[model samples]
Target: MATYEEVKDIPNHPEKYLVDVRNASELKETGVLPSSINIPLPDLERALNMPDDLFTKAYGRDKPAIDAVLIFSCKAGGRAARAANLASTLGFVNAKAYKGSWTEWEEKQSQNI
Candidate 1:
């Protein structure tokens, strides 16, 4: 588990994994990480096919494996942490929870249009 603030600086994987569990309305009301891809928890059971190029470019292919460090974040971290844990049970070795989530993001002075 990693605090939301901590992951801000760490680079993602070549095929970076960012799962935003917030609902459509919450997503509209609140913003997301600049490079994050939304994968609502309910929909996680389905296949995941994010744009390879986009993820690769944002997160270098040098260090963490493609499937490692799957960052999970939601409204306030509760749901996200659960999701991350579940992902781990399903074989995602590097699943992590961003505890600070959107509520914290909004609180940050850096978050703005």
Candidate 2:
């Protein structure tokens, strides 16, 4: 699992991917993490399977390498953990879930203010 601090520092490492597994509507209701990309849980498998050029065209970012560092997060974390598991099964070597997810992120952001 990724720590809150690790998720918060994504901007410093361009090679790492911080993916928010929430749906578009959910993201609209609650803003996403700073550097996260949205590939809703339902569509994740297809997106990951797409060819590199197609993946980039669809998501506007390069497809992650098999050994890329992927950090997943969702509403309260369940989906995020599942996402990590799915990625692992698909041969991704360094997938992780942010256990606290957006709920913790929101709570922690409030604490900082």
Candidate 3:
């Protein structure tokens, strides 16, 4: 798993896949990471397996490879960790949770601003 500080560098790397596991309502209330995609936890697996063209059409990005460095985040760490575990079980080799998740991200962003 990665810490919030570690995740801060992810946006600079185009090959990484950062995913937000929060519900749409939560995302609507709180902004998301600039490079992250929203694939609510419930739809994660299906979204990951979508055809390349379909996935791109839906998410505006190509689907991540099974061995891609995938980082999952949520409001806190719970759901993110769960999503990471699920991704691993589904054969995603490098899925990891953002240890401090969205809460930490928000805190850090506020500090920067």
Q: Which predicted model would earn the best lDDT? A: 2
Residue pairs with backbone atoms closer than 3 Å in model 2 (clashes):
none
Tens-digit lDDT track of model 1 for 1-113: 77655556545433656678777778988777656667678866442333556444543432334367778889889999988877877777888888988777677736654
Candidates in order have lDDT scores of 0.68, 0.96, 0.90
Clashes of each: 0, 0, 0
Off by over 4 Å in 3: none
What tens digits encode model 3's per-residue C-alpha lDDT throughout 11-77? 7888998899999999999988878999999999898878989999999988888899999999999
Residues 12-107, candidate 2: write the lDDT tens digits: 999999999999999999998998999999999999999999999988899999999999999999999999999999999999999999999999
By summed lDDT, the worst window of 10 consecutive residues in model 1 runs over 57-66
Error of 3 at 108 (Å): 1.6
Residue 81, candidate 1: C-alpha displacement in angstroms:
1.0
The estimated TM-scores of all candidates read 0.71, 0.98, 0.94
- Ranked candidates (TM-score, high to low): 2, 3, 1
